[model samples]
Target: MASNRRAFLAATAVAALAAAPASAAPADPLETTARPRPTTARAALAELLAGNRRYATGGSRHPDEGLLHRHALAAGQHPFAVVIGCIDSRVPPELVFDQGLGDLICIRTAGQVLDEAVLASIQYGVQELHVPLVLVLGHERCGAVAATLDHLRTGAPVPGHLELLVDEIAPAALRTRHLPGDWAEHTMRANTVWVRDAIRADSAFAAATVTAARFDLDTGLISVLP
Candidate 1:
């Protein structure tokens, strides 16, 4: 049954893909925004991965940014996934995933830290928007992780409200200290896992598939972690 469901989803995604070029000058305008959305979490993840492949290989279609599509989306948004990521300027989720207007609901913080507001926003996406997937995206050599590591080691005060951000990421920095190799990278991965787990544990949020991933800056590739 699972395989059959996957096959059906693959066909639906193909139908959606074929409709992409028409979005350049969509006849109905809203038609582009109405493509068959991934019905399951695995299918949604696959779509995101496919988009990332296009982005990494320099073959992005840059779908759904057209003026007509923008106008159509003014009526409503039905994004497929909720991306929880870091505030790093380099890793814009839309660009990295090659998705466009109304395709993803994104919430970003330094180290992808979760607080009440972030959790609430994500909950709204899953419960109200019925988004199938929630991805916590971390990246290589994350600045937040590095800062937390340094601040924790030195016991120096971080300036301004930035201390709150570092403090949120402190657990990952401390947890990965015993691991070999680069501290920041390990902490970043650990932090993504922690955030993913936290979201899963949150009773307030509606049911959705939660996952963690890492993005490599040099390669422009994103990988889902085990």
Candidate 2:
């Protein structure tokens, strides 16, 4: 009789505990944190292009640059795209796309060349960050392409590590030589396309959408290439 009473008391306590409201468990860190941006590659591409259009029209919204957004991103980043662009001062990816902080993972090199470091950065954006889109952006009258063309035409050696840049861009210059446009412009577009194709072919970037475009200096317009 004593054991039965003890068992009954234990059952009552357990039932009461079960019936009691779950004291809202401390908020889970992962659940409480800001959710990542939900976007598809096509959507991300469209958003970027729209931002570029706004910037070109002098109507940039400059979204997500405020204090609250910055603080939220301090906890974690959820950029939607990875932009591989030139190191040109005139062609800042953030400004050109009119995107604000945490909008893009930008990887820049002269002529947008992809060495091991650049490739690894891009892979991180695609594989880890899950950025939906990768954009290879080149600009008109790119000095890198021009220098490569000059070097190819003159066979003169470029000084120091600058020659590395010329070497990387030379293939594109050579490939576009027979095309019927201004050499620099043709090579610029070709270089963008070449890099885009290279990124697209990477197994690491297989899940991400990759594309190329050229930024027009005079018009401030970005033209997506075929």
Candidate 3:
């Protein structure tokens, strides 16, 4: 069932991408102001979850992509949420959540690993931009977490800066070793939770809410973890 869902989503993504125009000429700009931003974490999270439901059910409205929206965003962006997700080509936050321009502050890293720079970027979003919510989004079949599991089991050396990813993810892999499920999947969820907790613990992010979620590659659904 899961595999079938995954195949369906993959086909859907391909069809959508193929049907989309290569480029669109800018539409006449509308004289409009930016929409009101979500001021509370709960409100921000509700907006994201609603968008995800639209995407999962194939009812995406593709809002905020018009020329007026783009032009308004050029002045300044007040994204309501900060999404920390994997750098997977297939799991773009915008498309997955069905959000458009200036709706989210997206930060992607392999395995959703956090370093000084990633942390700083998230901090900026929460503190400077006053983004109300931060989402740590992990997905099924993450190559980075899988590689870390491989390295742990085989004691193999990963060459170059890629090893850094393995190193950061190793702790999550180790922590979840005793759990009764697929190692990679477990590690993915664990990593997401770990990062969420880390962000919540950070002093700079105290004003914002931090949460973790797993993206089902098969169904294109995002399940928020408790």
Candidate 4:
């Protein structure tokens, strides 16, 4: 079943990519007011990594996301990057990465699963907001991952509607079952890598932006995949 879903996802991505405008084709949408400029993808990625490093080392320079910041962003926003992270309260992208309002376009889902809503949010980030980078942030000891691991090992279906999230993550969890160290932690990292690849392989956004980085919660460090 997992394999079938993966194939379905891959095919969907291909179709979306085929429909997207070619990268080389010239046609910039007309913009009113001053054009909203975004940082280069690499630069924006670096900033996020640096902030996460600070968070890990107890040296975080927290962003001021106060009332003034909110008001300034109400009329318009030009976030530099998009972060599709888990719904885990501990993994809030703004606080963990020390970013202010209008700094990041964030989308959260349980297990960081990609559904239509999440994909649309990502599309809006790249095509409309001109965000240069997108980060699929996943953390250690994720409850969703833990649940999936249980489902894989014990053959016990995740209870109730939670099965949907576990089902999405079970493939990645099963792949890492033989790896060294704690299985839960291993599964967590594997889940992060899997989600990262899912975004990179997406048809529409892959060509528009580089999909190449993951942040590990345990180390509070960013790992760039070649």
Better by TM-score, candidate 3 or 2: 3
Which 10 consecutive positions of candidate 1 have the poorest summed lDDT? Answer: 25-34
Off by over 4 Å in 4: 1-38, 64-68, 210-219
Winner on TM-score (1 vs 4):
1
Better of 3 and 4 by lDDT: 3
lDDT of 2: 0.88
Clash totals in order: 0, 0, 0, 0
Off by over 4 Å in 2: 1-38
Writing each residue's lDDT as its tens digit, candidate 3 over 67-128 gives 76777779998898999999999899998888889899999999999999999999999889
TM-score head-to-head 1 vs 2, winner: 1
lDDT of 4 by residue, 1-226 (tens): 9999999999999898789876644533321122233478878877887777888788875563555556667899889889988899878888788776678888999888878899899999988888889887777778888888777768876678897898788888788888888887677667777877777788778635555445666676666654
Tens-digit per-residue lDDT, 1-226, candidate 2: 9999999999999898789775544544433344345389888888888889998999987776765577778899889999999999999999999888888999999999989999999999998988889999999988898889889888988999998898788888888899886989888888899999998888989989999988989989998999
lDDT of model 3 at residue 225? 87
**Between the candidate structures 1 and 4, which one is better when assessed by lDDT?**
1
The whole-model lDDT of each prediction reads 0.89, 0.88, 0.89, 0.76
Clashing pairs in 1: none
